[model samples]
Target: MAQSSSKRIFLCNSCGNEYFKWHGQCPACSEWDTLSEFHPPKSRRKSNGAPARKTTKLHTITHKKDRKRTSSGINEVDRVLGGGLLPGSMILLGGQPGIGKSTIAIQIVAGCGKSALYVSAEESEDQLALRAERLGINTKNLHVSGENEIMNVLEQVSVVQPSLLVIDSIQTVYNEDLDSLPGSVSQIRDCGQQLLNACKQKGFTVIVIGHVTKIGTIAGPKMLEHMVDTVLYLEGDERYDHRILRSVKNRFGATNEVGVFHMTSAGLEEVTNPSELFLAERTANTAGTAILPTMEGTRPILVEVQALVSKANFGTPQRNTNGVDSRRLSMLLAVLEKRLGNFMGMNDVFVNLVGGLKIQDPAADLSIISAVASSSKDNVIADGTVLVGEVGLTGEVRSVARIDQRLQEAAALGFKIAIIPKGNMKNVKSFKGLKIHGVKSVREAFQIIF
Candidate 1:
């Protein structure tokens, strides 16, 4: 076999396109100033004629009995993983610097209850030990190392032969063969590929911690995300103690699954019932407030939607929202003004979802409109009332998916009344201690609530 010489090339960080020369704009993605220098590893070729690779028929391949998933010892973590962690799978955990990425990673490693190696490229062994102690983890099976060299780390892995391997971060480790510095596009791609290969061959689970860019995406080429088996993100506001662990991509589990946690003095504690936690501090019988039953993956949760409308202070009415889509709020406001009257056009509107949860459920559309209308009219929605439906452009209340599940969750939380889309009424089986009101239009809903 002969090794081919490696060449320096340019790569677009946005689209992962290769270029022989640097350009201000990437030709593939049309993104400006996203190209960076990269050195691809040398390739090996056989001196003699190449032989055909072996192949196996898909139907003939049998599943291994020992390939079953094992619990990570954390119920919330296992839930996001669709039950448990599978052996030989590569997972990526990414989040902001202080948003508890390392905390959760260490917790998972400690809870795996197996011989594990923790490779920390950015922290010392002492720092890791302190963190483990603070989290009340005292396990002899977990080994800590401060190596950042990719080859040396692999050598340690070979020596340890542990069932689990964790890389504190993918950005700080670099391959010696590549001239690019650590965290560079070339280093991340090459090192990540090497880890993936090792995970597949050695049959040990690997969890790689990755940093996110300012835009909240994992920092690296888009291909890096495609190389992992699962991608989890830790998100929360610095001002709040609530944290959300969400799965955006998963090969074995359903995506968009979320696990709620609260930051405590000791460590992150899982919230068993997020609905109760989110509505714990609700002000009863308050104007500009509505309850919405939304679904996160297969779990149904009730979140509070609040809105405030005031007279415009400036030339134009100010429209601001937190944890709610700005465009959706604008459209809802327009609907309220056109369908109802010009009340909102002359007022400033602000809508916020309690508990720092950002929801994309269209079932919240009716809730948002209800809250906004309640604030504008200075009237409070009745106690123990929840709204679930999608508001269309023509002010018609549209049906939402999983209406039965949403209503059942609301009912379990002691919600006495529910305003749902008329189209979904047939799907409701009726629950004890709860009353359902079906509305055909937003006007009808207002008439009933007011």
Candidate 2:
């Protein structure tokens, strides 16, 4: 077959590996059958800008913080957006289907109640209108354009000159310039690049709503994330209505600064203090329940950790955890069993982060082990104690990062007792009002808490 050739590249979405041809397996991330071919549009032969933008020195780059930003009028969005949308900035918001990525984008664009353009290759205007009705957002300022073709979408963007622009999804926008179907690797890369370029040149705030794969990666070329200024992931268990907008990448502010939103009759409602929502109302004190303080961006949050210990029925012990890594939990359990000799080897240990938000940080390790030990021993931890430390495989309690920040955050939130590492304890010496306990090993940790 004669290839009507276009210079293109195949990128592994799992690892950001770029290749000349598609492969059955990724050479980098070792993900099976995840190669997606992408054909990017060559810059228009004649219309390309001359004297390409020069890379300026770091100090030479002008700082213009005082520049005005058009607020989306949604406090949660504004906070997640680092005060508000920077003119011509491209923001990517990825989430599960029907998890309200579109809803939040639509809500944000509805600001100023001015005519903002909403382009959706996925949903028709009628469908979007129905959603708007359900959300009760008056779409008066929202100019709706339903299209699949990238050229047509660009045309609408050029003609409307909307103050705010929202693409319901980046995956569905297909480009005729790319020799592939929409949502394919090539098409997504080309469409995303073009949209980002247009956003920068046009000075219109653009939010590209995206869909994520089951493994929690944005369902497109990894280049899509790099090409944008901000990348936000909307997280929540599909069975639950609450959604978390977490900044995975941010050029304007801190990544990991998250805003909590609950999907409801009105729309995505912001939860100012997510701690209350994460902690269930427990009338009575229970063993194996721990509250830990974590710093998300600049905000401090208190989350509950629960664990249960039962006699293991099988030859090998079974370890399970929710909203945390099972392998890490297993290692922590092993530390407790081997070094501390807490008789947890045959226990069917189960650990859970009260809310469904997955915490991959190593700091949660000590709490996981503590929760399980507390359960096994049937001892309840103090109400004010907040456990924060990394438990090593050898049963040593490693110092956690940003102890001062954690302590300050914990102190701000009314936590009085903190179980931290010995190294951090020596550095701080004294934690003024809060009773900070330093533990070197898992045994010490247990003794200090229980």
> Any idea what lDDT model 1 has?
0.89
Model 1 lDDT tens row, 1-450: 122224778888888888788999999989999999887766532212225547878756575466788788878889999988888899999999999988888888778788899999889999998898899985689988999988788888888988888998999998887777899999998889888878777789999999999999999887788889999999999889989999999999989899999998778999999999999998789999999999998789999999999999888999999988899999998898889884676789999999889988888999999999999898999989999899988899999999999888888889999999999998687988899999999999999898
Judge candidate 2 at residue 126 and give its lDDT. Answer: 93
lDDT of each: 0.89, 0.80
TM-score of 1: 0.94
Best candidate per lDDT, number? Answer: 1
lDDT of 2 by residue, 407-434 (tens): 8766766678899988787677555678
10 residues in a row with least lDDT, candidate 2: 43-52
Find the number of clashing residue pairs for candidate 2: 2
Alpha-carbon runs more than 4 Å astray in model 1:
1-6, 42-54, 60-63
* Model 2 score (lDDT): 0.80
